[model samples]
Target: MGQLSKIEWTEATWNPAVGCTKMSPACQNCYAEAMSHRLKAMGVNGYADGFKLTLLPERLADPMQRKRSTIYFVNPMNDLFHERIPASHIRQVFDVMKKAPQHAFQVLTKRADKGEGFVASYDASHHPYLAL
Candidate 1:
Protein backbone atom coordinates (compact mmCIF):
# COMPACT_ATOMS: atom_id res chain seq x y z
CA MET A 1 0.00 0.00 0.00
CA GLY A 2 1.02 3.66 -0.49
CA GLN A 3 -0.19 4.65 2.98
CA LEU A 4 3.40 5.19 4.13
CA SER A 5 5.91 6.80 1.83
CA LYS A 6 9.68 6.66 1.61
CA ILE A 7 9.86 10.24 0.33
CA GLU A 8 12.06 12.24 2.74
CA TRP A 9 9.99 15.39 2.84
CA THR A 10 6.69 13.79 3.77
CA GLU A 11 5.70 11.31 6.44
CA ALA A 12 3.25 9.46 4.19
CA THR A 13 1.49 9.31 0.78
CA TRP A 14 -2.23 9.73 0.34
CA ASN A 15 -3.18 8.82 -3.22
CA PRO A 16 -6.96 9.16 -3.25
CA ALA A 17 -6.46 9.19 -6.98
CA VAL A 18 -3.65 7.85 -9.20
CA GLY A 19 -2.42 7.72 -12.82
CA CYS A 20 -1.96 10.57 -15.30
CA THR A 21 -1.23 11.53 -18.91
CA LYS A 22 1.88 13.26 -20.21
CA MET A 23 1.06 16.83 -21.12
CA SER A 24 4.40 18.39 -21.98
CA PRO A 25 8.11 17.85 -22.56
CA ALA A 26 8.79 17.92 -18.82
CA CYS A 27 6.60 14.84 -18.47
CA GLN A 28 9.17 12.72 -20.27
CA ASN A 29 11.24 12.62 -17.10
CA CYS A 30 8.43 12.58 -14.59
CA TYR A 31 9.24 10.60 -11.48
CA ALA A 32 5.61 9.81 -10.97
CA GLU A 33 5.25 8.46 -14.50
CA ALA A 34 8.24 6.22 -13.93
CA MET A 35 6.95 5.12 -10.54
CA SER A 36 3.54 4.41 -11.97
CA HIS A 37 5.01 1.96 -14.42
CA ARG A 38 7.16 0.41 -11.71
CA LEU A 39 4.23 0.10 -9.34
CA LYS A 40 2.14 -1.38 -12.13
CA ALA A 41 4.83 -3.94 -12.94
CA MET A 42 4.85 -4.90 -9.27
CA GLY A 43 1.05 -5.30 -9.40
CA VAL A 44 0.44 -2.48 -6.96
CA ASN A 45 -3.19 -1.69 -6.29
CA GLY A 46 -4.70 1.39 -7.95
CA TYR A 47 -2.19 1.39 -10.82
CA ALA A 48 -3.71 -1.25 -13.02
CA ASP A 49 -4.04 1.20 -15.89
CA GLY A 50 -0.54 2.53 -15.43
CA PHE A 51 -0.63 6.24 -16.32
CA LYS A 52 -4.08 6.54 -17.81
CA LEU A 53 -5.51 9.02 -15.31
CA THR A 54 -7.81 6.95 -13.12
CA LEU A 55 -9.45 8.15 -9.91
CA LEU A 56 -9.80 6.07 -6.74
CA PRO A 57 -12.60 7.30 -4.60
CA GLU A 58 -12.15 4.37 -2.22
CA ARG A 59 -8.90 5.84 -0.92
CA LEU A 60 -10.41 9.15 0.17
CA ALA A 61 -10.82 8.16 3.80
CA ASP A 62 -7.23 7.03 4.29
CA PRO A 63 -6.26 9.94 6.54
CA MET A 64 -9.42 9.72 8.60
CA GLN A 65 -8.50 6.19 9.63
CA ARG A 66 -5.14 7.22 11.00
CA LYS A 67 -4.95 8.49 14.56
CA ARG A 68 -1.42 9.86 14.39
CA SER A 69 -0.65 13.29 13.02
CA THR A 70 1.08 13.15 9.64
CA ILE A 71 2.43 15.15 6.74
CA TYR A 72 0.89 13.69 3.60
CA PHE A 73 2.05 14.18 0.06
CA VAL A 74 -1.26 14.26 -1.70
CA ASN A 75 -1.46 12.52 -5.09
CA PRO A 76 2.21 11.89 -5.64
CA MET A 77 1.17 9.90 -8.70
CA ASN A 78 -1.06 12.59 -10.24
CA ASP A 79 -1.99 16.25 -10.18
CA LEU A 80 -4.87 17.37 -7.96
CA PHE A 81 -5.88 19.92 -10.57
CA HIS A 82 -5.51 17.78 -13.65
CA GLU A 83 -8.08 18.64 -16.30
CA ARG A 84 -9.84 15.30 -15.86
CA ILE A 85 -10.16 15.50 -12.08
CA PRO A 86 -13.53 17.09 -11.32
CA ALA A 87 -14.11 19.78 -8.74
CA SER A 88 -16.62 17.53 -6.91
CA HIS A 89 -13.93 14.94 -6.43
CA ILE A 90 -11.53 17.64 -5.25
CA ARG A 91 -14.23 18.73 -2.86
CA GLN A 92 -14.43 15.22 -1.53
CA VAL A 93 -10.68 15.15 -1.07
CA PHE A 94 -10.86 18.48 0.77
CA ASP A 95 -13.74 17.23 2.86
CA VAL A 96 -11.61 14.33 3.99
CA MET A 97 -8.76 16.72 4.72
CA LYS A 98 -11.15 18.87 6.70
CA LYS A 99 -12.25 15.90 8.81
CA ALA A 100 -8.70 14.80 9.41
CA PRO A 101 -7.40 18.08 10.78
CA GLN A 102 -4.62 16.30 12.64
CA HIS A 103 -2.77 15.80 9.38
CA ALA A 104 -1.18 18.31 7.02
CA PHE A 105 -1.57 17.66 3.30
CA GLN A 106 0.83 18.87 0.64
CA VAL A 107 -0.95 19.28 -2.72
CA LEU A 108 1.20 20.24 -5.69
CA THR A 109 -0.25 21.00 -9.10
CA LYS A 110 0.87 22.57 -12.36
CA ARG A 111 -2.54 24.20 -12.70
CA ALA A 112 -2.24 26.76 -9.98
CA ASP A 113 -5.05 28.94 -11.32
CA LYS A 114 -7.54 26.11 -11.28
CA GLY A 115 -6.27 24.96 -7.92
CA GLU A 116 -6.72 28.43 -6.48
CA GLY A 117 -10.23 28.73 -7.84
CA PHE A 118 -11.16 25.34 -6.46
CA VAL A 119 -9.74 26.14 -3.03
CA ALA A 120 -11.67 29.39 -3.01
CA SER A 121 -14.96 27.54 -2.51
CA TYR A 122 -13.77 26.31 0.86
CA ASP A 123 -11.95 27.65 3.90
CA ALA A 124 -8.48 26.70 2.62
CA SER A 125 -6.36 28.65 5.12
CA HIS A 126 -5.21 25.44 6.80
CA HIS A 127 -4.82 23.27 3.73
CA PRO A 128 -2.16 22.80 1.07
CA TYR A 129 -0.80 25.39 -1.33
CA LEU A 130 -1.12 24.84 -5.11
CA ALA A 131 2.30 26.27 -5.83
CA LEU A 132 5.58 26.04 -4.03
Candidate 2:
Protein backbone atom coordinates (compact mmCIF):
# COMPACT_ATOMS: atom_id res chain seq x y z
CA MET A 1 0.00 0.00 0.00
CA GLY A 2 2.94 2.29 -0.57
CA GLN A 3 4.32 3.64 -3.82
CA LEU A 4 3.29 1.80 -6.99
CA SER A 5 5.91 0.89 -9.55
CA LYS A 6 6.78 -1.00 -12.74
CA ILE A 7 9.99 -2.74 -13.73
CA GLU A 8 12.82 -0.76 -15.24
CA TRP A 9 16.61 -0.75 -15.22
CA THR A 10 16.35 0.01 -11.53
CA GLU A 11 15.59 -2.60 -8.94
CA ALA A 12 12.58 -0.57 -7.88
CA THR A 13 10.89 2.84 -8.13
CA TRP A 14 10.67 5.61 -5.58
CA ASN A 15 8.13 8.33 -6.16
CA PRO A 16 9.00 10.94 -3.56
CA ALA A 17 6.55 13.15 -5.37
CA VAL A 18 3.74 12.38 -7.81
CA GLY A 19 1.86 13.99 -10.71
CA CYS A 20 3.09 15.88 -13.78
CA THR A 21 1.98 17.73 -16.88
CA LYS A 22 2.61 16.54 -20.39
CA MET A 23 5.24 18.52 -22.29
CA SER A 24 5.84 16.37 -25.35
CA PRO A 25 4.36 13.70 -27.56
CA ALA A 26 6.29 11.17 -25.61
CA CYS A 27 4.09 12.17 -22.68
CA GLN A 28 0.90 11.64 -24.59
CA ASN A 29 -0.04 8.83 -22.31
CA CYS A 30 2.00 9.44 -19.24
CA TYR A 31 2.00 6.53 -16.83
CA ALA A 32 2.48 8.96 -13.95
CA GLU A 33 -0.66 10.87 -14.84
CA ALA A 34 -2.74 7.75 -15.07
CA MET A 35 -1.34 6.39 -11.86
CA SER A 36 -1.88 9.67 -10.04
CA HIS A 37 -5.56 9.84 -10.88
CA ARG A 38 -6.05 6.25 -9.81
CA LEU A 39 -4.25 6.79 -6.56
CA LYS A 40 -6.24 9.95 -5.97
CA ALA A 41 -9.53 8.14 -6.26
CA MET A 42 -8.13 5.51 -3.93
CA GLY A 43 -7.45 8.37 -1.46
CA VAL A 44 -3.69 8.35 -1.36
CA ASN A 45 -2.68 11.30 0.82
CA GLY A 46 -0.25 12.92 -1.59
CA TYR A 47 -2.36 12.39 -4.68
CA ALA A 48 -5.36 14.16 -3.14
CA ASP A 49 -4.69 16.98 -5.54
CA GLY A 50 -4.18 14.62 -8.49
CA PHE A 51 -1.29 15.46 -10.83
CA LYS A 52 -0.56 18.84 -9.28
CA LEU A 53 3.07 19.18 -8.32
CA THR A 54 3.41 18.48 -4.61
CA LEU A 55 6.51 17.78 -2.55
CA LEU A 56 6.64 14.76 -0.26
CA PRO A 57 9.45 15.40 2.15
CA GLU A 58 8.29 12.51 4.31
CA ARG A 59 9.17 10.04 1.60
CA LEU A 60 12.67 11.42 1.20
CA ALA A 61 14.27 9.12 3.72
CA ASP A 62 12.85 5.83 2.42
CA PRO A 63 15.99 4.98 0.50
CA MET A 64 18.32 5.29 3.47
CA GLN A 65 16.93 2.28 5.32
CA ARG A 66 17.32 -0.21 2.52
CA LYS A 67 19.92 -2.96 3.08
CA ARG A 68 20.48 -3.92 -0.53
CA SER A 69 22.61 -2.10 -3.06
CA THR A 70 19.76 -1.03 -5.32
CA ILE A 71 19.31 0.91 -8.47
CA TYR A 72 16.45 3.23 -7.61
CA PHE A 73 14.54 4.98 -10.32
CA VAL A 74 14.60 8.36 -8.57
CA ASN A 75 10.98 9.04 -9.46
CA PRO A 76 8.93 7.00 -11.85
CA MET A 77 5.71 8.81 -11.00
CA ASN A 78 7.06 12.34 -11.31
CA ASP A 79 9.80 14.50 -12.69
CA LEU A 80 12.34 15.64 -10.11
CA PHE A 81 13.30 18.66 -12.20
CA HIS A 82 9.81 20.00 -12.73
CA GLU A 83 9.80 23.80 -12.64
CA ARG A 84 7.28 23.76 -9.83
CA ILE A 85 9.75 21.92 -7.58
CA PRO A 86 12.05 24.31 -5.73
CA ALA A 87 15.78 23.95 -5.98
CA SER A 88 16.07 23.54 -2.23
CA HIS A 89 13.88 20.43 -2.34
CA ILE A 90 15.90 19.06 -5.22
CA ARG A 91 19.03 19.55 -3.14
CA GLN A 92 17.43 17.60 -0.31
CA VAL A 93 16.75 14.68 -2.66
CA PHE A 94 20.32 14.80 -3.89
CA ASP A 95 21.56 14.95 -0.32
CA VAL A 96 19.70 11.76 0.46
CA MET A 97 21.15 10.06 -2.59
CA LYS A 98 24.63 11.18 -1.62
CA LYS A 99 24.21 9.74 1.85
CA ALA A 100 22.87 6.46 0.48
CA PRO A 101 25.70 5.53 -1.82
CA GLN A 102 24.66 1.89 -1.68
CA HIS A 103 21.71 2.80 -3.87
CA ALA A 104 22.25 4.07 -7.39
CA PHE A 105 19.51 6.57 -8.30
CA GLN A 106 18.39 7.26 -11.83
CA VAL A 107 16.20 10.26 -12.62
CA LEU A 108 14.57 10.99 -15.96
CA THR A 109 12.92 14.25 -16.93
CA LYS A 110 11.14 15.52 -20.02
CA ARG A 111 11.79 19.13 -19.06
CA ALA A 112 15.23 19.45 -20.54
CA ASP A 113 15.60 23.10 -19.62
CA LYS A 114 14.84 22.51 -15.99
CA GLY A 115 16.99 19.41 -16.02
CA GLU A 116 19.88 21.47 -17.38
CA GLY A 117 19.41 24.05 -14.67
CA PHE A 118 19.42 21.36 -12.00
CA VAL A 119 22.58 19.87 -13.48
CA ALA A 120 24.27 23.27 -13.46
CA SER A 121 23.60 23.67 -9.75
CA TYR A 122 24.37 20.09 -8.69
CA ASP A 123 27.59 19.28 -6.83
CA ALA A 124 30.00 17.63 -9.23
CA SER A 125 31.61 15.58 -6.48
CA HIS A 126 28.31 13.90 -5.77
CA HIS A 127 27.02 13.73 -9.33
CA PRO A 128 29.71 13.10 -11.93
CA TYR A 129 27.20 12.07 -14.61
CA LEU A 130 26.09 15.65 -15.17
CA ALA A 131 26.96 17.12 -18.56
CA LEU A 132 26.18 20.60 -19.84
- The most accurate candidate by TM-score is 1
Residue pairs that clash (backbone atoms under 3 angstroms), model 2: none
Q: Rate the local accuracy (lDDT) of all candidates.
A: 0.85, 0.79
User: What is the number of backbone collisions in each predicted candidate, taken in the order shown?
Assistant: 0, 0
The digit string of per-residue lDDT tens for model 2 on 1-132 reads 123345755577777788777778999888889989999999988899999888888988988888678878887889888878888988888888888877778788888788887777788696655453
Clashes of 2: 0
Off by over 4 Å in 2: 1-6, 128-132
lDDT: which candidate is best?
Answer: 1
| Per-model TM-score on C-alpha atoms | 0.89, 0.87
| Candidate 1 residue lDDT tens string, 1-132 | 237888899999999888777777877888988989999999999989988799999998888999889999999999988989998899999988888888888988877888888876777666555333
